[model samples]
Target chain A: MKTTITILLTVAIMAVGQAAVAEPVKIGMITTLSTKAGYLGEEIRDGFQLAIEQEGGTLGGIPVELLVEDDGRKPEKGIQIAERFRTRDGAKIFTGIVFSNVAMAVVPKLVREDVVYLSANAGPSKLAGDGCSPNYFSVSYQNDNLDEVVGQYVSDAGHKNVYLLAPNYPAGKDHLAGFKRYYDGEIVAEVYTKLGQADYAAEIAAIRAAEPEAVFFFLPGGMGINFLKQYAQAGLNETIPVYGPAFSFDERILGAVGAAALGVKNGSQWTHDLDNPANIQFVEAFRAKYGRTPTLYASQGYDTARLIGSGLAAVGGDLSDLEPFKAALSAADFDSVRGNFAFGANRHPIQDLYIREVVQTEDGTFTNQTLEKVFSNHVDAYAESCPQ
Target chain B: MLFFVEQSLNGLQLGITLFLMSAGLTLVFGIMRVINLAHGSFYMIGAYCGATTMAATGSFLLAIGAALIGAALAGMVVEVLVLRVLYRREHLDQVLATFGLILFCNELTRIIWGRQPLFMDVPPWLGGSIELLPGLIYPIYRLAVIGVGVAVALFLWFLFSRTRLGMQIRAGAENREMIGALGVNIRLLYTLVFGLGAMLAGLAGVMAGPIMAVESGMGEDILILTFVVIVIGGIGSIRGAVVGALLVGVVDTMGRVFLPSLFRIVFSNAYADSVAASLASMAIYLLMAAILIWRPRGLFPAHS
Candidate 1:
């Protein structure tokens, strides 16, 4: 009887020890998965999942549990998901928020709780500046970076007068401000339309009357598609060249906008046609898997996942204490798809921005082709305000 | 002067689209007494069907036909399956049930079409702009929309005033039980009326599909405007819808274009632009309130 008891105890001890060593790290992804902009989150989630799957359901040779939940594009919903992830599921790592408003709502609270929040999209100005925290890292460009590149390009091209248009919202104002920062040109008019206004006839008429040498608009998602199609239909595209950030010129939007987007110059950090080895591999694999070209959002997500994998490998997957993992993450020792990518003092990306022109491929599909390097080692305007 | 003319035309075009939407909503509410929050869902459905058909056939006219038939059929199905019982229920219950229908329809579209917004191109024949004036160039499609809207208004007027079925529908609107006792098939009439209303909404959707992103929930934005148009037009009056739509459209367009310039005369350019944008969106609501105060029942109350 005593021999039997001893054998049972040893077996139970071994089983408990094995379970502790094999426990997977939890990474909670709170993203917008519904609404007009749902595709943005879908691409990000797919890209991130692709990275994890490439690692055989692990990151940095350690098993990980990726928990993804849709926020329905609501800040309140995002906060609820974050709280549940932290308190109930014990998730220490979080990523995948597409919109800036939800990011602002969720990131500050999560970072304060000693959890790392890696942003796959939406690097709002506030988070990049005075509100910057060590626990937060943005794998994507700052919200204004893409617009700033276009502004610089437009200015360099000697366009003396430009008409600016954007939806009337916080991000809209931020984009116009970013453009003006680098654009040394005359602003004929600055117009803010109602958010979600489908019809742009009034705005188009105003643009024609003003007759600016060039037009720069910051409409994203369905708004962009509407503006581009109507702008083309109104015959404005023939006389006045148009410029914008890359948000509206992604592959999915290009398919929707078709020839309207062709030849339009937009700003982006990465394109599927990027020649780097990491980007090449990523593009091919993504297209093979999803049967669609990867957008800049997908690149950011894939980079974010790889960055986390690097941290996990450095710490040998031990997350009980976050200091070593934090140090490893700060190191940023990963091959980014965007060549020469690094973290700024505020933990936002300091990388190259390229001017990409939309083109129809030989196969008759619309996609972007990188034309010129607009900015190299570019730091965000708000990064200087960061205490770090 | 050219800018003013173009802006006015733009206003008229917007008014026409709103008219198409409000006319249908008013008819359903006037004749059937069902407050359908799901009216927008039908609009969305029509756009989806139009877009899918456009992709498959590459013919805009066929797409329009598909949209009309699809929306009318969907409306009849809803009338039979869900709305027939709601006619006897309270307004609050009707609102709740229709709201649920909107959710179901939205989800159903998402499941079928996927989350990505679908694209529909303007028909090639009507693709370009024409010079309305020496300096003013306007899209041929916008003018076509205005033409269509005017044609539809005339048709509705003739149907209500001259046709036998129209008489029954008008009489039915006056008193549901009286029409039933007078040997009309009230159930079939109600279904037909609902289907006609849905068809009008579908026409609006097809017209809008090429201009806007044909995506899920695209209906809700215009739906709010349609509601406002109906309320301002007298809930059950077609004439009210016409006048209300034009007034709202012109006021909205003119306000957006000229309000900032007016404010700039008094305030700084920056301050003027911000205030103008805020007030422009509010212009329609402000108009509704003023109208309600002046005429407690809309411009042409059909009931009284």
Candidate 2:
């Protein structure tokens, strides 16, 4: 009996040693977790983790290792993390950046290192414009492309005058510019609040004076919540109909503002109520695991993970097959939360933009419902402008 | 002319709210001589409390009341438990300890309220727009805010310039040991002063809740602006906080509104738009820097 037991133990030890030599694929995830930014980062982490778990902890016959590093919402920290991942962690692919500046900083580093970077949430405009690079593929839409729909919706609806407001930063400027692109209506005024400002009284007062037919804005993160709440409080919602991109009216923000977001319209590429097979599965799995409604950020994150999965699979488990892997991702053969989509010439996403109305769910939870569809099979106008 | 009048009102209103925040911070600094970086955390707590209570009870007044009281309670608890031990400690220790409090409180707030923002909204009756000028219609909520802020400032002025407790607070601010020798209960007074400061900070947070996001780190952002107010107004002066806050708010507002048009005359429209946006954003910091260059101690310093 003792001899038999010893033989069995020896066989188990040898099998474990063999497993240690198996090929491993490492994907670096730099996110703003463990901070207020974690609201979105947690969603990103969950989406990636869920995809890996669904694949039974393996991607294309190799065990996957997700190395998550906190960027702390700092652009410099993101680059540092990406450099560390490339040099030390032996990661061949980089993913996840919730803020645009962080993505702006890390995208070049990953490209310089010849490592593929998948932007999960941030939609920096330059990456789809003059700064476009081959190694950088966005699993998300351009920041302005989404906002362009909001401008178009308001302008086409014959709104004569609109007010524009955003935080005083690069993202905010891009947002206002994008809005004016599709919106030919007379812009009454453009007000830029301080970056990360908590109060909007002066801005609110300015909005009051503007008395616009409509208001279009792009103030993501905490800024969005402050603007929306203050706008609702100042009774601007009743005076002028508000329109924005996905960030202003998403599940991530609705809970905080709750009924304050009621009647607010936002343009997005996807919504939880998108009524598609891919989205249904994605939403179901996310809700089941998280016990809450997933935001557009989470949906985009899940698509990015699937994008990485397809690239890995197409290369036949070979991490070194960069050419074949890039081609597979470019072909867009994988499932996405936004349904059928493909990367344009600039490597930015070309997908449908959905106009969602902020409405509470049947379960009394705050969520956005798809009201109308805008910009079907939308290709970013910046693709032509891109010097790539 | 009407726009200027309206802009002045806007500036004054902003100043008053900043005063409410800065008044407490400066008092805590001047009296306690402890740099409480987590002071903003208490403000956030008050805002959250105000928002949650208002949402639950559907009473704006009650929410404000709960916010002030709750903030005071949180402040006193910190004074007794955490800050009391640090009274005789070094500035580095005080700063580090308070920094830890900020992290702990921010996370605690997140755990309680979740990651989403809470909509502490304006009451229905207070949420209508008033036609102040022919073309300019201002929200009645803002007008109410102005009234409240001004009243609070006046009330605070009276409290400090009048009552016996105010006298004791002034004495304490002048010299803790001298006041202690005069048979004053220094410990109780410190807690009371902290509680009062916290209540004022809470008042600002609750008042601003309907106009801003009631979330974790909300106070931290405003805290920086309030620091600018203190630097501009002079520390530990209620009057200075008011003046500084108003100037910062109005200058910031005007810069954002007119800078683009001003730049449009010299630069191309696209360049002016981006450049103006960047400068407008930096205007307040520039003003702060300029003010510091002229008056290193502040416009109205309580101490020489």
Candidate 3:
């Protein structure tokens, strides 16, 4: 009777230990995977998949399960989906959102739930600033970080009498302000076009009339594509050089913009052509799997997965241990696609930003080629304001 | 003076685009009394066909032909299969059915083309800017669009006024039951009218392909604008569509360009700019509201 009781106790203890160590890590990815903004989410999801595939379907030594739900680019939908993942799926680590608005919706709830929110994209400034939570970590740079670098590049290049264009929105204002903070040149004119306004003929006409030395814009997604096409159509691309952040010149958009995007300088932290072995492997594998060059969103997604994996490995997959897990995540010991990636005090990346020029490659496909380093070990502007 | 000329031209170009979209929508709603929320899907289909054919054949003319035929045929099929039944039903039912068709079309597009936006380049012959005035330059492709819109409008006018089909269409719009009782094949007329409307939408899509990103749910973006244009122009009148399109276009363009600067004279630059931007976006809606209050049936009510 004594032997039987001892054996049963031993079995119970072993089962508990196994549950702590071998329970498959479930990560819930809430993103805009459908509608017009679906492409962004698609790229991010593909990158996340690629990282898992590269790791042989395991993050660290533990098996990882990814639960993906489409937010449809709506904040309400994102919040609902994230809630489902938390309650139904028991997902503690959440990742992947394309829009900052969607991120703003769910991140607070995620923080309150004591879940680790790994932002692959949509690093809104609010989170970077005083609202920064210890539970939240952005694998991607803050929204203004790339624009800041572009601004600095424009200033350093000595482009005088520059004109700025952006959609009339809070983000647009933030982007222009970020640029103006670094650029010491004369802003000949500042134009805020309507959000989702396709035709830019009037704006183009104004640009021609002004005839600034250079033009900078912060139009992302379809807006950027439309503006660049119209800019080229208006014959402005020939005389006036264009500068923008990498969001407007990413690989997904280069195909649509085609030759028009050529010679345009944009700032980014990661490019496909980075020399690091991890990045080289990632780019080649991504191309082989997806049949196109991965955008910066994809790179960020891949990095997010690896970053989480590093943390998981350090803690031996015991995510229930919160303090040690956070510390492990902050360590960021993975080989990043962007070389020399490290976390700042705010838990956003402090990495090198490069000025990338859109160029037609030998194969005739347009891609962004790294021109020069703009900011090295660049920390986000709001990091100091972050209490965490 | 040059800026004024250029902006006016820009406004005119916008008007033409709106006309192409509104003409078909107005026709469908005016004649059929069948609310077609899916008309925008035909526009999207036209764009997809244009882009695909343009890529396959490398000929803009061939792409245009394909777009028109593709959209018209798709319209005819949908009419025969789905919209035919809705003709006898209430407007609410028609709207619900057509809205479902919009969702269906969007999903179908995504399934076929994937999520990436297709790029359609202007043919080399129409790629450059034309010297409109001494200092002002406008895109040749945009001018081509204007020309096409004008040509189509004239052709539509001729169709309605001079031709037997036009007379029949006018008669059918007036009294569908009367035309049906007078030994006319009402079903065939309805199909033809819907096909023609779809064709016009396709033409607009083909023309817009070079300018805008061709992607899924693109139809929805312009769908609301087309509705506004139709509502302002008088639901079923082609003349109303033309006038309304031009008015809305000019107002919207001018407002976007000049409002902020005009306000800056009175208010602080920052406050003025933000307010102006918001007001400019609302300018068209405000105009529509005012017009509706003055003339409840729109600026040119077709039936009256």
Candidate 4:
């Protein structure tokens, strides 16, 4: 009887030991989860969780542990979070950041410390270009990529004398530059407003005076909502069409802007109506879980998680083999929601960008409907500058 | 000439909005001698109330009514529960407590409304743009804003100079203890005065709803500008607030519109733009500084 009891106890101990060995792989998620920017971060986190839940709480056939931290939209706070994740948590995989400047501040430190940094939302140009790292991969498009597509489409559609508006900042300047790269037509006026400027009446008056064929803007968040509301109120929506990147007009924004955003065309890598299996599943699952349609940021977040899963699976749940892990990530094997997803040499997304029009669904809800593909497996212009 | 006229109208529209916000702030400080840092929270509450009501009821007028009532009620509640305790306290205590209230209100708003901005549509009747000049058209809503601001200014003037309550308020501002001893219910008066100030802020919020994004923290941004206006106009002076609001608004709007072009005369377009952009934002502060240098007690000190 004593021998039998000892054997049973040994068996129980072994089972517990095995379970401990197969503990969920931990990944650090540093994203803005407070303030107005918190919405973007929350959506990203939700989408990411949706993907994990769809995989039955496992990534790459391994139970995954996600350590989420709020950066409060501060770069230094992001750095601090990254440090804790790296040193204290021993998390080798990092993903999810909403702001470009925050990501810019946090990414280099993570990459230098040998952590695989998967960007879910922000795709700063510097990271995509000369500062590209082998360990760093962005599941999101480069900041200028969508703008470039929009610029091309605008030029192709033969819109002459377009007025441009963006905030006075780096991302804003990048957007205008990206637009100018393809748009050969004369820019009637290019105006930069103060960042987070609530009133756009003066700018609207200027736009009306310019009488451009079209107006392109890159105001995100509340600024976009304010601008669109004022633009619609000024009766410019009916006559002068507005064009922007998906950042300006997405599912999240369209809902807030209501009918005002309708008929606005935006360039994007993913929309809710994409005829792709991955996207359909993601959109349905996201809506079911979050009770709202997924925005571009959400899609990027989902893709980042899925991409990490693919890489982890290929590496056989081992990130210690740096070459194999990097190769696995670079293989870009995941079925992307954007449909034809690949990575450029710079490790940013090389995917089709669609020209999506804001249209009302059958249920009176406004959402982005894909009009046509603007670019097929589009590679960013910064690849030449990237060494890796 | 057409450009200048259009810009000026835009400036006036902004000025009127600022005036609505500053009026409440100045009045509250004048009568209560309470530094209410959380005044902006009332503005946010008003905008939220208006936007939510507009969305639910689809009546623009109802939205305005809801905004005023909601903000005023909220203000009275805060005064009874919080401000009543701190009236005799130091300014620092009031500042700290109100600052904490700002955080609480912001978080509460986030929980109630969620993080996404709520939209308030311009009423159909007020949506159309009028031809202010032959070639230059301006939105009628903006002109309405100016009209509302002017009317409110006159109403405030009357309230200050003619009414018995106005006299009491002025008397209270002059000597709170004296007014208390003169058979006036000080607590009730304070509550009523705070409610009035909050209602004015709500009016500004509802007015701004169509033109601005009705979201959390929306009040704080404009609050800073309102403070600047009040300071330039002379703290606690309604007439000073009006003058300061217009001055700051016109200067800010015109600076934004023309500074880049003005700089382009000397520098290249890109260089001029970056330089002018910074200066344009700072232009209001510059004006404030100039005003201070010229008149240390502001343009109109209420005490004087």
Candidate 5:
């Protein structure tokens, strides 16, 4: 009787040990989760989770664990989270950072440590240019892509004079430079307001005085909502059309701005209405799961997840060696939600950009509707600066 | 000349908004001797209440009423529960407590409303712009804000100077112990004063709801400016708050408008713009420093 009990105990222990050997890969997601701009991270998280859910709690047929921590929109906090994820959790692959500043702080160090970092958002120009790394990949567009598209579109539309406005920040200056790259027109005025400014009465009055044929602004989050509402209230929207990147006209922002954002032309790489199987499935699945239309940030997050999944599958879920996994990621083997998506030599996105107009659906919800393709297979201008 | 008029009007509108915010902050400091960093929390609460009420009932008047009552109730509750104990404590303790309250209120609002900012539109009656001058169009909502600010200032003056309650409150601000000795319920008076101050802040919040994003931490941005207004005007003086608010608002607006153009004559356009924008944001601080250098107690020192 003692021998029979010992055999049963040994069998049970062996079964448990076998299960432990197949433990899931840990993917650390360090993103902004608490701030006025927390919604951006929320959408990204929801989108990334939706893809995993669609795969039945696994990515690319391999069980995976997603560890998400809020950076609180601070770079120092982001570094702390990354260190914890690396040392304590033993996470080898990392993704998800919402802001360029935080990304600039965290990404370089992670890549230097030989951990693969897939960027879900925040493709700062430095990362795309001189700082590009084999261990790092941006599944999202370079920071300037959307703005460059708007610049080209505005120029094509024959607007001879345009007034530009953005916050006085590095990203703001980068956006204006991107716009100027493709825009061959007279810049009537280029004003940089204080970052996080609530009022635009003085600036709006100045724009009226300048009498620009068109206006382009790059105020993201609540700043965009305030500017759009105030611009409409001033009755400037009726005479002078406004243009911007997708940052200002995201679904959540349009809800806040109400009818003020309607008919505003903005440039984006993906919309819910994109005519592609992956995107259609993503939008439908995301809406079914989350009960809201996904933003462009969500699209980026979903794409980043799928890309990582492809790399994992290529390595047969074995992260014991990272060279093969990196190679698989660089090969770009995944169906991206943004159609024709590819990685440039610098590992930033090379994809078509489109102009989307804010429109109210039949159900009376505000969202972006794809208007026309603006740039086909567009690559970031900084690709040449990176030695890949 | 037309551009100047439009810019000046814009400055006046900004000044009026600042006045509403500073009035409450100054009153609270003057009466309670409590430096409430959470004063901004009341503004946030007012905005949230107003925006929620506006969304549900679709009545702007009801929204205004809701904001006033909501903020006043919150203020009175804080005065009774937490601040009553801290009344005799050091200003550092009060500051620490109020700062914690600001975080608490911000997080509480986020939990209730979610992180997405709430939307409040200008009431349809006040939606469009009016032709103020030839080639100068301004939003009617802004003009309404100016009108409301002016009316409230007049009402505040009447309440402080003409009413018996106003005299007692002024006396309390002058000497809290003496007023209590004269049979005035000091605790009740403090609570009432805090409520009134919170209500004024709420009015500012609701007025700003249409123009600003009604989100958590919305109050912090304006609160800094309010503090500047109080400091420049005088800590306890309503007259000082009024003058300080208008001056800060006008200087800020005009500097933002004209400084870039002025700099362009001397520097390259792009260089001038960046330099001027940085300087314009600093203009009010420079004004405050200059004023402090001349009059250390502010433009109107109420105590002496």
Candidate 6:
């Protein structure tokens, strides 16, 4: 009975997928869907899936088959998927990478394969800097670019003393360095917690003692959740205000932290409650389909799918024609939900930044409301750092 | 003072959770001599099932009750099918098998629930935060977790000391053949004990859902800290697990807080900045290394 059921399910799945791909161009979505980062990957897949499905399985007059596969969040596994997509799947273009390590492993191969990699995520500094590849383009900005924005926002807010805190990872180090680059603020304290360290009482106490005017952090995922909740519980609000990147309070974290995220000033490239027809359409469509606010990760994924589709249309889906595809991707001609995003000289998106406020809806669902534009057509520092 | 009291309470609350996880893992290892990496998988399963059941039935108590029972049943099913084979095998074999179980659980979760995180709400009765000290509110649900942990610890202590089944477990731990010779149903005992450990793990999961997001693969994320507790509290000893959990909870909290500032005082500001950052991150692991070096057998080794 089990075997029979399994076979039946497999057959059904194959037929549904094949029917979708029957006429449209086939694009392979090499992503992680069975590990720690799977939730984010799923959100990405949903954003793309909804877009493709709503377009009646056609993109730019081509029936699009997004062949989804899990990389298991392993670098080797990601490389293998890339290989399979190029050799076996005959994939012309690729998108969807959540981890920087996996992106690093796949980029060199994408260069060799001559496949235009429209990176929806994984904005590693190396790709934006000396290691920039002509075949590779990032729809997402550099990781530290957000930190640099945080630097500018806080410094311009006239806060002289700021404490920098992050998990003691390479990303944390880069983020602190990024913030320090633009802000001429006095560093009263800079602390790093272990990755996956949920408890932060001691850190909170230390912050309380040091008494910085402001605190900026770059914690993401569950670590961010842990930090925000604990910081609030420790009564640091009476002492210091917190400021940092927007990812900590993205749509994915809405109900888990509840009202704790209110008043947390964040630097965001795009948010759900932005005042634009494209963003309005994106958020409404996303909400209508998924019954939830689209996270920036999801927004990026949607933009990525649309961007890749545009690039494919530019080249008529022929990856072998490198010059057209490269030029098309470099143009960054897509109605991004983040508003007009165009590629800078380094082939990374140069977009506006907004200071968003976390507001509660009537149903208690949380969404970001853009309060003010922090930076317009902001190009990252790493772009100038890149000679290319 | 109110803030300190609240954070310490929070620390104690977190310690309660670590205790629940450590209790289950220690028992499975101490007597069964099985390295079940899938232990956290059961916890994940419980959280998923409990939250889902609650969402479906709209009964939070029923959801938690079902969570424990569901986890135990799943534990037994796994023991019967896969774990029974690895019982007498080498530790490496057990590790490999359980590691495979972790992967299976992860994939199975993705297949069953898509890739999105499920929102798990605490029943209205248990959801709100409390103020043990003025202006220092702690979540009421977290304090309840501490209560549950204490109750479970007492129940376990009494069961192991007085109950006949507990005596059999003790005997089996000392000599498996002797218990078998005494006409104990050794296979069933193993099955029941595994189930009980799984129930504890599930309880921790069910309680933690509202506090943390219920997503696939969260088991692996927290499994490391649970293991750290098990190692610090000598493996298989409940008391050791409890003490070890407390030490780890406090040290981890303190390290992340204090280490960076201490470094800033002793060294050049920039050098201290980097050094303190790294050291603060590693403080708990450093503490673990120090403890292990001093006491190779752990602070309290249970003699089975």
lDDT of 4 by residue, A69-93 (tens): 9999999999999999989988999
- Best candidate per DockQ, number? 5
Worst 10 residues of 3 chain B by lDDT: B268-277
Q: lDDT of model 5 at residue A263? A: 94
Instruction: Write model 6 residue lDDT over B98-203, tens digit each, in one string.
Output: 9999989878887897665566765678755566666556556667788999999999999999899899998998899988998999999999999999999999
DockQ of predictions, in order shown: 0.76, 0.56, 0.72, 0.70, 0.79, 0.27
B1-304 per-residue lDDT for model 2 (tens digits): 6766766776666767777888898888877888888889878988999998998999999999999999999999999999999999998999999999999998898888887677767788898678887856677877888888878888878888899998998899899999999999999999999999899889988988887777778788878888888888887776678788888888877776678779989987667766887898788899989988999888888788
Note the residue pairs that clash in candidate 4. Answer: none
For model 2 chain A, give the 10-residue run with minimal summed lDDT: A198-207
Range of the 10 consecutive residues with the lowest summed lDDT in candidate 5 chain A: A31-40
Which 10-residue window in model 1 chain A sums to the lowest lDDT? Answer: A16-25
Among the numbered candidates, top lDDT falls to: 1
Shares of reference contacts reproduced by the candidates, in order, are 0.64, 0.60, 0.57, 0.61, 0.67, 0.35
Predicted candidate 2 versus true structure: per-residue lDDT over A194-276, tens digit per residue? 77876565666666666778888888877888777767766667777888898877787787776778878898888888877
Error of 2 at B57 (Å): 3.2
Off by over 4 Å in 5: A1-16
Quote the chain B TM-score of every prediction.
0.99, 0.96, 0.98, 0.98, 0.98, 0.94
lDDT of 5 by residue, B1-304 (tens): 8888888888888888889888888898888888989888888899899999999999999999999999999999988988999989999999999999988998899899988888899999988988877777789999999999999999999999999999999999999999999999988999999999889889999999999889888888888988999999999889999899999888999999999999999999989999999999889999999999999999998887
Ten-residue stretch with the least lDDT total in model 6 chain B: B252-261
For model 2, what is the error of residue A382's alpha carbon versus the real structure, in angstroms, after optimal superposition? Answer: 3.8
Docking category of candidate 6: acceptable
Give the TM-score comparing model 1 with the true structure, all chains together.
Answer: 0.97
